[model samples]
Target: MFESFWRANGEEATIVIPGWQTMSYFSDVSNLCWFLEPEFAKQIRRLHGLVGNAVVEDRHIVVGTGSTQLFQAALYALSPSDALQPIPVISAVPYYSSYPAVTDFLHSGLFRWAGDANAFQGENYIELVCSPNNPDGFMKQAVLKSDTGKTIHDLAYYWPQYTAISSPANHDIMLFTASKSTGHAGTRVGWALVKDQEIAKRMTKYIELNSLGVSKDSQLRAAKILKVISDGYEFPNSIDAKFFDFGRNHMRNRWERLREVVRETGIFSLPEFPSEDCSFTGDRTSSFPAFAWVKCEWENAQDCAAFLKSYNILTRSGKHFGAGLNYARVSMLDRDETFDVFIQRLYSIK
Candidate 1:
């Protein structure tokens, strides 16, 4: 999706890291997240401030392998070790499918997966709030109301390109990743903006023990990419140079096309989103989500995923996200050519 954008504007995004530049295990011995490269931290704050997606001021940054690792670390940090039973981890229905799989697979005594935050009766739980959520692009909050519960905000899709930044998010633990933000999944860099120092430390400790520290090379590379992105916004001379603008345009166009095909076929339906004012874009922009929450309207199409597959269109089953068989999750982040093929395929569907 972003390959062409980078190929054209990657001159300033290059980092020439020498062998001896960042070879040590520790980036800053004085900082609590000792392995977090200063350059990466600086770039993260600068980008977030520029986008107005999250409030990074006075927040502790914990760099991880990716948002997945940071998510697991959050589970590790929030769960009470001395509790009589494992702390239940819950997210709203039609949540990111990976949440339950990631949480329960570990079989950790500290935390366990409990289906649907709305249905969970336990008082002690950790809630995952993925605004501009993955499987379905809905903005969500902590559905479970309890004094003892903690929330981890997965703001991966909260960027201006995906949805409106109505206001800067000020959650207790907010997660952001480079993959969704800059289309740099290979770098595998993600950070958490945690309000509490103790939780930040615990998250950092999990990383320290898990991977020894996030790769300094990866951090440096991510820093360069982010710096270029922030610079584009600060000094916008060309359309090609603007990162978010480019992303927003691509998403909007793809969504418009997708919606058109859905309307044409009368076999599928998409969620209708209301346009909202974006603080960063400074305009009322409609949501151009990274994923489409597609529903099968045809009576014979009992399984949405399998139906798409019959037409050689791959999609994730909504059942995996705790939704009914009628729904399917389609990725809108593919390259331009692939997306065009998908659009064409949709029209061919009976």
Candidate 2:
């Protein structure tokens, strides 16, 4: 989706890295997070400031290999080293499937995967709150209400393209990724905005021990990409309309097409989201989620994903996200050609 947008600008968006440039492991030896490239940090803050999705002022910016690494870093930073047992990590049902998998993959001594924050037992825990959530794009708040329970806000899909920015998200720890934001998954760049300095330090330390710091090359590219995006909005004659405008319009059209096809089939249902006044767009618009939460309404369908597969359209069962087998997640972020084929397949599924 964003490929064309960047391509339209041509060399205006290109970056060149010399063999001699960014050779040092340390981007800023003066800062605690020495690996953090100064340019990347600046662009991260500038983009956040421009969008007003997350507060970046006076907050420590911790970069990662991607949001996946940042999430693990959060878990490591939040869990007390003196604790008698590993702290339970949880998110609500219909959460991002990777939450549990990533938390328990290593069976980390710092934290362990605990499914569904709503059913979580105990006082001390780490709650991952993904707003405009994955699998089903709904706004979320921490379900566990204990003072000892810490929360990490995953705002990966909180951009104007996905949902209305109700207000500036003020959270202890917030996570955002280039994959969702700019469709730069291959770049493997993500960052966290931390209000607490110690938590930021611990997260940075985790990256240091894990990957010996993030890739300087990736960081530089990410910085360049982000600067171009922010520049689109800041400078009117610089290039095109806001980078998000391209994303938002494309997503809205996709959602409309999907909903119409689902209605025509009458065998599937999609969750309807109420429209909200977006602060950025300054218009009342409904969220056009990057993922469509489709549930098979047919009585004969036992597995929604399998049913779609039989139709030669691939999908992920909602069971992966702690939902029923009747429900499935269909990504709306695929290529235009692929999406057209998917829609046609759904129409022929009778």
Candidate 3:
């Protein structure tokens, strides 16, 4: 959907990296693995401040190849090393599908997938809280209230384009990725804002063992992109500025159009989100979620993904996200032509 937008403003988003630049694996003087480039860190802070999406003060920034790596690092950092039993990792129902796999794939003795936090009764556990959640674009909070439980806030889609920047997020551990925020999925850069130094160090160690560290080239490119976004805010009226404005407007338009199509179908339903005041935009706006959580209401179309697939519209099955087969997720971030095709197929359903 944003292909035209990017094509029209390509020059402003372009970055040129010298071949010899960032040849070293090391990103900073800290010698610590998972070291974030100072410029990258600075740019991240600047971007957050400009966008009012996340709180950065008094936090240790740990960069990763992407949030996927950081999710593992968070599990490593939060789980006790000497524990006799595997630490339980959990999230609420309809959670991000990758959490279970990311937590259990290593078969590490330190942690194990514990299923839904809402159903869990464990004392010591790590709960992943996704606000403006993955499968469903709704705000979420920790369901487990155990004193021994630790929480990692995944604020990947918390940008103004996806949801209102309600406030600067302050948590013990918070994760953000470039993919959802700036549409830089290939950059493979994500960062965790950690409140504790020890946890930060341990997460860094996990990154060290995992891939040695994030790519410096990716970091530099991400920094440039973030800087461009910040500059857009600084000079809102500039010809090449206001990337977030463009993104938010485009997303809102797509959501409205999709809703119109779904309404006409009468076989699918979508979640309703109330408009809220955005700290970044200084106005009230409804959510323009990255994905559409479509629920099939027809008896014959019990499997939402299969139902959509029958119409040549592929989607992510809700069963993958711990929701029932009646639900499915459709990406709203595809190219305009693809989105048009999806809408056409969707409205054609009888």
Provide C-alpha RMSD values for all models, in order: 1.2, 0.9, 1.5
Which residue pairs does candidate 3 place in steric collision?
Answer: 1-334, 1-335, 1-336
- TM for every model, in the order presented, reads 0.98, 0.98, 0.96
Order candidates by TM-score, high to low. 2, 1, 3
Which structure among the candidates has the greatest lDDT? 1
Q: How much lDDT does each candidate structure score?
A: 0.92, 0.91, 0.88
Candidate 2 Cα outliers beyond 4 Å, as residue runs: none
lDDT of 2: 0.91
lDDT of 3 by residue, 35-147 (tens): 68888899999998888878899888999989999999999999999999999998999999899988888799999998888889868999999998998999888888878
For residues 1-350, write the lDDT of model 2, one tens digit per residue: 67777777646668899889988889998877889999999999898888889998789999999999999999999999988889998889988988988999997888989898888899999999999989888888888798898999999999999999988899999999999999989999999999999999999999999999999999999999999889889987876757889899999999999999998889999988999998887989999998999999999887999999999989999899999999999999998899999999999986
lDDT of 2 at 182: 94
Worst 10 residues of 1 by lDDT: 231-240
Candidate 2's displacement at residue 80, Å, is 0.8
